[model samples]
Target: MNTRDAKEILLLYRGTTDDSDPQFCAALDYAKSDPELGQWLREQTKCYDTIRTKLRGIEPPLGLSEKIVRSRPIPFPRIWSRVLQLAAAIVISASVTVLLMKWSERRNHSVAGAQEILVTGEVLDMTCYIAYNLSGPDHAECARVCIRNGLPVGIKAQDGKVYLLSGEPGHSVNAELADYAAKTVTIKGRQSVRDGFAQLQVEEIRKL
Candidate 1:
């Protein structure tokens, strides 16, 4: 199987110890032969483990799980596949809901994230922006330095909205930033919250 196909099938592996899954075996063997792919495979496993850990960390509201559990699972070709699909669907749904929630806050109140909206905002270093309200050319150099030093980057919309920027899906934040710091740019993304912080999972960015 090619790398793409192998990656999809391996999603079902779910840390299982069963060696009988031919698809998982094929993906492993392919990854083993390729240095870069092997590294990626390892990294993907680490990311999944981290996500599972965080999910466990969240203290659900009382009886939330019971309510969720009371909902019967629909028959799917595979339970794991259904779980993954449901997770993906939930993310999209949750993102939209969060965006709308933000919109409900105020007229042109941008202190919230937006989903599928084209917004014009000033790029800034997240830490500096929150602590000092710094942005634009005056802070551009400092922002770049801070970002390179591993500080988070974000954008501030005209309506006083702040959004922590992240890459879409599998992209790395650092790699995606690539020096758009402290500039006014337009972005299209899914506006979502992670750990209660606003995030723009950027799909597109255009300098304005």
Candidate 2:
């Protein structure tokens, strides 16, 4: 089987309850008939068995059961009366601060020659591109293209590629994109324009 087909079969084997089904039994029989496929299946089965055995041995900490059963029911007033009031005030103040900061940042970035736009779509796989127009044909124009296509907040262009910056604490795409956009930046490969949108190809997506 091809790599993609193998991957799909492996995924199905991991997720489904059809191991005893006729089709699956036939596939297993076919795999066993081939030396390489037999070895691969054996390895996968060993791994799955090891993981299952390890998981089966796991148990909750000693006293966790007693602690849960003995927990006291807290009175509503004693539980959240003061905490809720304080938390509400804090949330309101924090929300106002965040809104003001966002507004200020938006204005400052706009005046500083950076623009922002939203790119919304369900990313199909971990490898996808943020296509943009480069027909204006200049490096600055490319930068502008990056900015106008969701760059100002944290995305940037480097070596003609658009990079989504890590918001804080590290240099990596946030976890939200970890399962969609493979890398922080995507290199522009082949591009074309159709229906008023520039389509740029992204390459080199593989699990690290």
Who wins the lDDT comparison?
1
Candidate 1 lDDT, 57-168, residue by residue in tens? 6576998645755696535445676478547643543344344334323222342445567768887766445544456775666666555533466778989888877664
TM-score of 1: 0.43
- How far out, in Å, is residue 183 in model 2? 26
- What's the CA error at residue 5 for candidate 2, in Å? 2.3
Candidate 2: segments with Cα more than 4 A from true spot = 1-7, 11-18, 63-208
Worst 10 residues of 1 by lDDT: 100-109
TM-score of the candidate numbered 2?
0.28
Worst 10 residues of 2 by lDDT: 125-134
lDDT score of model 1?
0.60
Which pairs of residues collide in candidate 1?
110-161
Give the Cα lDDT of each candidate.
0.60, 0.35
Residue 59 CA error for candidate 1 (Å)? 46
